[model samples]
Target chain A: MDFSQIIPSLPSLWDGMKLTLQLLLLAVAGGIALGTVLALARMSNSALLSGFAKAYVNYFRSIPLLLVITWFYLAVPMILNWITGEFVAVGAFTSCLVAFVMFEAAYYCEIVRAGIQSISKGQINAAYAVGMTYSQAMRLIILPQAFRKMTPLLLQQTIILFQDTSLVYAVGLIDFLNAARARGDIMGQSHEFLIFAGAVYFVISFGASSLVKRLQKRLAV
Target chain B: MNYNWDWNIFFKSTGIGSEIYLDWFVSGLGWTIAVALMAWIIALLLGSVLGVMRTLPGKVLPAIATAYVELFRNVPLLVQLFMWYFVVPDYLPEPLQIWFKQDLNPATSAYISVVVCLALFTAARVCEQVRTGIQALPRGQSAAALAVGFSIGQTYRHVLLPQAFRIIIPPLTSEFLNIFKNSSVASLIGLMELLAQTKQTAEFSANIFEAFTLATVIYFVLNMSLMTLMSLVEKKVRIPGMMGGAK
Candidate 1:
């Protein structure tokens, strides 16, 4: 209930929020990029490419994000060491980011696939009739429409990604939640700090989701 | 850099056949299922009520339901779990607080907190799904029930809910699977669930890959089976020439 304790700790919390935002933005960007490719692969004619993408999406989607973060946290350094001839240190931040990107990509792939499939096949046939190559048709025609149709779902998923950034605490990454917990522990006002942090998360996510709803309405028109 | 891999550690007893690392995993799996099942009961019951309230013919109830969904759905489960585990107990009456802190078993208390936290968190999502399912029903469905002398409650109970449940099987299945995955967050509050047990085994044996790989495979199996089971249920309950059926 007391805002006074949390006010004095805003500076440290902001530092954690920056890392949290960094992870969220980077993961979302990487996830969407990879997800688009995976979606296309899933739709492709080749068995091997589609099979690999399906397996990747299924394996990632089936597990807990916490476990994925832990796995990458523990395994990435070893993988890096094997790749290079030196002992490489993948920090918790990097490992967490990698895990988020990899894990979220699976969900995003499904969204992107649904978006692409929503576009009428006649449009693609028309593009081919106009002497457009497959890649050109997809780039200039299909992807643009698919991306537009999927913007709201994409934003909704981003809201989910924002909430899940708190899971980085599992790997000892001091995200916004952990930062608040640390300040609370120091001040013996764990309740107040936690309540404040929860409110902050609510406001941001609720705001973002409403924006998505608005965008969805506008797109409907 | 001596990274030892001991896959056999899973079979080795902790001490004189008391238990093995694999036993920890099995117990953890049991707790995970128990938590998920209990939370699922809370979610279905509460979510249905909230969903009905949102669709009712009043402004106040729907507003309250909307607020509840927005509040619970927006916050991360980890933060909510922390609040329930660490903060909620403080708000209890002095006698109850004393009993909670002094008399109750710590593990049982942790388990209850996790189940409650996860249930409320997921109930918000289920509320949305239920709302959508109800809204998707044809107006004539309810109108016919009213014409047949059914009250509004009877209309919803007999005419709407059955069809809504049928319509929402797929999403509900996904939500059910999600709760199972989300149960992993309970490990943060020191519940020795599957993920926590995997972490324990990994740290103890220093074979992180072996331990986590086993955990991942177990999770994958659980999720895939749920997916298959739900799909079968979907097929069984699917309205003829609707939803999943080809016209």
Candidate 2:
């Protein structure tokens, strides 16, 4: 509502954006790696590995992100301190990163599971016929193909993750959405806060959507 | 082997009985389920109408639909709720302002605002999914229905929605989970949902681990149960002929 005041507070907004970007990058990168492992484990032929992976994803996936973040940032450290020397509690950004990784990994595991499961089973057999080890067959044949189909799913998940960075605000991280709130507080203008923050989210999501379309085009799908 | 896990302290702070921490945890779980159920119902009803309208032939309607989706879909529900709770009230008429100030409780208003914001936001996603499901049906079914002189309403009722819902059930369940998870954001505005309760409990008991752990478990149980129910619904709605279309 107060343009004059908000314009001057852009630097604070930028700070929030920095936090948002770092959190997203960490969560997405870590989540994708952790998720891939979780996915493979879930899909593993070994019952123990599959059950472990399934439990990991199921437990994390079922919980809300805020609850998880609060737990890690608050509880885990307290428990650690109770036993021994002071624990290295993660900063707000890192706390969200860890929680989002666990949460997003659960989802990514499923996405990867769907993609991996959807691949024709006989492709592995065909790869095996060529004297490929199971690992070799998976690495060379099944996954590359699965990766193609996962493009859209991956894009969708990324967008959802981006939006979820907003939740990190509750943990006291000045994310993009949080920046808007700060702006509102400083300027006493909620409209400016929401409008700018909403625009930031929209840009990120729309950008991801376009990237997906580009990937589809390049893949000629 | 030096890791001494003190189960007793955690048990005392977090376990059952007149423990304030445990009360917060239980109440938090109750709030999460309450808001999710309330928001899901509103979204489903509103979204179904919009979804049905999307398929109807009208230039004006599609634009309206597009605008509706774009407005809600593009923004974070948190921001929407924030605006609804904080900014929108100021713009209301004078009597409405007095009513909001004197008659309405901020806490209840916050929940109602959250319900409205979450419902509209989620309804956009549901509308798209439903519309996709409905449209993905082979063109022939609707064509055949029309050939038999089935009215548009009749065709939608008898021929389209039933099959579309069958195909959309799996994704629909996922949306249900997503919305349920999202409702936690209402905590920011002092809606004492699960997440907020965790914060309050942790502050009071200084047992953040147990308090939040309980909330997390409750969320896990709630979502898992919801997922199971949804998948069951998915199975029940599995029409044999609709297999080819669903994702």
Candidate 3:
């Protein structure tokens, strides 16, 4: 409805764009790695590691992202203070990264577990017959194939992570939504700017979705 | 800066020093479940009807279905909440707000807001569900209803909706849980639900960890229970020979 107002705001949007990319990449990289470990832990022979993974995934997955961000933002500082005599140099970027990584870990764990579960027992038997250890076989043979197959899902997860990065605003991060709100405050127009912000989010999401689509189709041969 | 652990303060705050709203927390869980149940019913009935509408012969009906889905699904829930609680009342004449203020409990406003938001959002997904169910129904069932002199409405009421609901049970369960989580957002507009109680307890105790740990544990139990109950229901709904509604 207000095309004229939204058009000029692209430069300001670039700042948000950079922040979004930074948060998305950092969290997805870190989160996916943690998630892989958690998935393996959950599936491990050791009951302790498996139980710990189960609790972590169950706890993180069940809570709303907003509440998680709030708790981490507040609790981290106090926990730090309790540990040390004084405050640490932890910052907003660090805060956002910690919360997103933990939350996304739960989802990625599920996805990675699904990938692992899909691998046939026959393949593992074959590896075992060749005298390969479980860890060696998983790392050398099974995981590489699974990771390749799980790429589209990983991409989709990245998009969701990008969308969820906006929740960092609850913790006072100047992410895209926060920036848009800042502009809206100066311009005195909340609805239009909110729509603009939503559109920006949609663009990032849709782009990733389409890329995933193409990848899925390409892999179908 | 590595520091010493203060288990003393943590335990003192979480335990004896301040009151946690256990009664409020339990009642809040009840209220959350209640709102989710009522909203799920509304979503099921409304969504099924609209879903049926999208499949009916009229071009206009499908368009109406699309419009409903798009409008409700596109906006953020927070904006929708603000509009319902803050904007809608102002549009009504001052006398109406005065009447509502006098007569309706503040909690009713919160409930009404959750229902409207939940129904509107869930209906979109429900419409998709019903449409899939209808399309999946065997071709002769509707014809049999028609040949028996059952009106279109009668056909849907007896023959169609039941079958459709059965087909969509699994997805519908998740939708119920989805609405349950979404209800926590109602605390934003002062609904004192679980999360609201969490915030209130946090502020009162000055120990955020104690308050939030309690909240997280409660949420974990409630949600895990929901998953358990839903699986039981799913098992019960399985018509003995027909597993996962296979043809």
Candidate 4:
């Protein structure tokens, strides 16, 4: 009901928003880079490569992101100790970053695979006829076209990623939602701060998705 | 690190009320299934109505429906859950507020908030699926129903919805599976769902790998079995020569 509490809390909430944007950007970059490799591996002729890629995608897709975040949170320090023979402390942000990137890569791999498959096979053949090596053909010809076709979908996934970054709260990360709730706990206006946070999330995600829709429409032609 | 790998932790007691770790997982599974199944019913029903509303022959109703979908779809489910849990109770009337905050069991309150939040969030997605299913039908089907003197309502009831629901079985099945996964979010608010139970077990026993691995396998088997069951339903109801039903 009361909206006045939100103004005083904007500073903390902005810090939270920055952290969210950081996770979103890093995850998108890492996920797409890893996903591109997985997609290529899945599409390659070797059965072992494709089989590994398939299993990776299927396993991640079947589980929830919250579980993945929790798993990484618990596993990273132990895995680090195994490598270094000493216990290492990893921050919540770092663990969540690894979790998001790994989890999102599986989804992006499927999207990128579909995008690559949409390109005509003759294009790859023509590249071969021109004496281009497979990597050269993929990097120069196939991937460029696939990226263009996949842009709208990739952006849409990024919007979803933006929303999902809020899950970092599971590990006690000071993301946007957590920041808002913290401020609310202090101000005794928990309701107002939460409603305000919800609105801010709505505006950003809804606006981004609308832009994606427009881009999808333009790309279709 | 030479970590202890005790596969028998599930059989050990938690030192409180004589309950074993396996009991935690079983109860957690029960809560997960209860929350997901209850929410799915609400989502399916409300989503279908909103889907039909968006396609109706009016500007206001469609706009309202579109706004509902966009509002629910864009916000993160966790934020929505927080709002429902921590905020919504305060806005209720005094007696209801007292009942929600003071009279109701904390676990029950958390469960109600999570179920409502998940249902609304998933309903937005289901609305789109239903809308697409309805729109994918050839226009002639609806027009022909009207031509035969069927009202719009009757046409939807008798002709359109049955077909639309049939075509969307595959996508709807995915949504159904997603509800189970999304139900895990309930844990963040202190509901002892599967993920929460897994975390508790890991911390209590210090067998992190075994705990998470078991939860992961449970989720995988649950999803795979649901997919198999839905595919069987998809086959049983497939209309010959229909778009998705075609081999």
> Considering every candidate listed, which one attains the maximal DockQ?
4
Model 4: colliding residue pairs: none
Q: Write the per-residue lDDT of candidate 2 for residues A1-110, one digit (tens) a residue.
A: 55666677888888888877787888888888888889899888899999999889878877777778777776555555666667666566666677788889988888
* Docking verdict class for candidate 3: acceptable
Per-residue lDDT of candidate 3, residues B1-247 (tens digit): 4333332432443353473356556667777777778888888889988899988987999999977865655444554554566546655788888766567899887778777777777888888888888888988999999999999999989998777777877777767767877777677667877777666666655656766777788777777888899878776666655644434
* Candidate 1 structure quality by residue, lDDT tens digits, A23-105: 99999999999999999999999999999999999999889999999889988998888778589877999999899999999
* lDDT per residue (tens digit) for residues B76-188 in model 4: 98989988998788779999999988999989999999999989998999999999999999999999999999999999999999999998998999899989999999999
Q: What is the lDDT of residue B54 in candidate 2?
A: 85
Q: List the residue pairs that clash in candidate 3.
A: A83-B3, A83-B4, A84-B2, A84-B3
Better of 3 and 4 by lDDT: 4
Q: What are the C-alpha RMSDs, in order, of all predicted structures?
A: 1.7, 3.6, 4.7, 1.3
DockQ of each: 0.77, 0.51, 0.26, 0.88
* Local distance difference test, each candidate: 0.92, 0.79, 0.76, 0.93
Q: Against the true structure, what is each candidate's TM-score?
A: 0.97, 0.88, 0.79, 0.98
RMSD of 4: 1.3
How large is the i-RMS for each model, in angstroms? 1.1, 2.6, 3.6, 0.7
Off by over 4 Å in 4: B244-247
TM-score ranking from best to worst? 4, 1, 2, 3
Q: Model 3: runs farther than 4 Å from truth?
A: A1-8, A210-221, B1-20, B23-35, B50-114, B128-161, B244-247
Better of 3 and 4 by TM-score: 4
| RMSD in angstroms between candidate 1 and the native structure over all alpha carbons | 1.7
B-chain TM-score, every candidate? 0.95, 0.88, 0.82, 0.96
The positional error of residue B165 in candidate 4, measured at the CA in angstroms, is 1.4
